[model samples]
Target: MHPAHPLLAVTHPDPYPYYAALAREQPLYWDKTLGLWVASHPTAISAVMRHPAARVRPLTEPVPRGLCPGPAGELFSRFVRMNDSRLHTRIKTLLMAYLQAQSQQACTPQWPAITLLSAVQADRFLYAAPVHAQAAFLGLPDQLHADCAVQIQAYLTALPANANADLIAAGHTAALTLQDRLESHLLAAEASPALRQLRDDGARDGIPAALLAANLAGLLFQSCEAGAGLLGNALILAGRRSLDASTTPAAARTVIDHVVRHDPPLHNTRRFMGNAIEIQGQRIEAGQTVLLVLAAAAMIEPDNAWTFGAHGHACPGQTLARSHAADALLHLLHAGTDAHALASHFRYRPLLNARVPQFDFSKDHQP
Candidate 1:
């Protein structure tokens, strides 16, 4: 069955055909059902994103209201992806240079271990593997990689408005711990040349170390769920092709790369208008939002990398994220995981945009 709407399509069993049609025939339209505009074609999506007044976060409520008055909110606000503050350009440039330089060093992620290759274990591994790899990429201690995943999960659980008091409190505590740890690492004498350079540049530019630390932690947050989706989808593609532990590392990476083009982790992203704008002959008022169907646009131009986004808001960690997912996949295969068996029995997690899969599940609930 077709999904009821674009947001619903993220979890739909087969959404590509619908997405293709969306990009072809209905490039941009008002989804009254969703109370916003939808941009499916590459042209329309680009138009909305390139507009200056279309900010990442809403103008009125910059940080999520639920997270306000809490450490979690502060950490969230400091992330480079969350705002277009004065320091944004400088911070992003610094991080980009740091990541590009760090990529040259040989670093292998310590893939999380599993006692069994059961469906439940795969579920846990999917989310943890990426965070573990990203933490290692940041030159964090091997012993702390697992803790990074746990803390990030707890922190994420507390972001939504309906979170319970206990979860929210736990999230605040987790945020503080992460901030302190990353800040210490960023300032430690033993830091790598690349990291040290980033620190010196941030200081020279008057960028706050606290903000730099939160963004360093933000790298983990960025990689977790989306990385799971990319890895999970790649596994499904591998299953269809009968890929196994015997597959060469090069072969595994090839499959992962294909997954990025055809079945990406993120399906759509949004742009909130700070001022009224006309796009594709449609007038969208201020405060309105345009849901950019990245997956849909990919159908039009596979190499465009609409999944990582485009323009100033494009994700700087694209290269790192892909390599991390590829390595994680190879690690899972070498661990004797039955990709075909696991892939045959799973459902997509109920996320607004990401398409992560859960191997262990009851038929009762999504995600």
Candidate 2:
């Protein structure tokens, strides 16, 4: 197979077979068309992500120039996700400590009453649930969860490369709004344990106040669509397997794990090399980009998929992400709505790295 063959993970429907081909034939081959090295093997992908020399992006331009000169741009520049090892570790420590302190109830969702006709409602609820969960986890006010979710979603949608002009504009506006909200929360003398711990620990750790807000926004941005996709993919799988309310939670968890391995919400992430590194004896030059096929890696190596980035650049919110995903799936399964009822109407949002569901259940559509 030619590396020049289109490997458009985003637009291409069912890229698994293509990914499998790479895993079998060229686990560490460079794709000329994508202008990046593709890492499909667990060992290679882990090495790249965990490598000391591996950078989230080029140090010369941490955040894209186009996003600079704005609040959203500022946040992107300082976000731990894009920073070097030192800063990333600091922020990640503070963030993960705060997240882990949160009670299980805070991150869990109360499943909404659902039906075959509940597709639209399900879509809306799932979209908002993760945002609310994040808000609750951050010790923010429950009253503003709805508005906060919308702003975060807008901000996240405009984050990827080659985003539309309108989307970028909307994201900036939402960023400013969130900035104001977070600033107000910090101003108050009374703070929840989670927020208090974050501020105190972050400050002691030398994390700037402004940087904390930016990263918090970053957390929200990541959670918004990911939560939706996790549930959406699980629903599709459940429907195919004919799972229902009677299915045990343990069984539902198995379904979630399988989906994460096969059809993860975030399919791919990019990493840049800061120094020459060798992966499986292949010399990767400095400044070269490596694409981590997360989904494919998971399928090839089951253990690593569940604990993505376990060694280097671990997802600080991995526990919460898993809990949220499992909760969403359990709720849907317990809703007792037949998966088949929603199968034919399944629709996905057009996103580069994420798979978001957009339900289109009309009044005229019968179950």
**How does each model score on lDDT?**
0.88, 0.71
Tens-place lDDT per residue, model 1, 32-96, is 99999999999999898889888888898888777778899999999989898778888999999
Query: Candidate 2 regions off by >4 Å?
Result: 1-18, 104-126, 245-248, 333-338, 361-367
User: Tens digit of lDDT per residue, candidate 2, span 131-162?
Assistant: 77777666676677778888887777677777
* Candidate 1 local Cα displacement, residue 134, angstroms: 0.6
Q: What ranges in model 1 sit over 4 Å off?
A: 363-367
Each model's TM-score? 0.97, 0.84
- The pairs that clash in candidate 2 are none
Name the 10 consecutive residues with the lowest summed lDDT in model 1.
Answer: 358-367
Task: Name the top lDDT candidate.
Answer: 1
Span of 10 residues, lowest total lDDT, candidate 2: 1-10
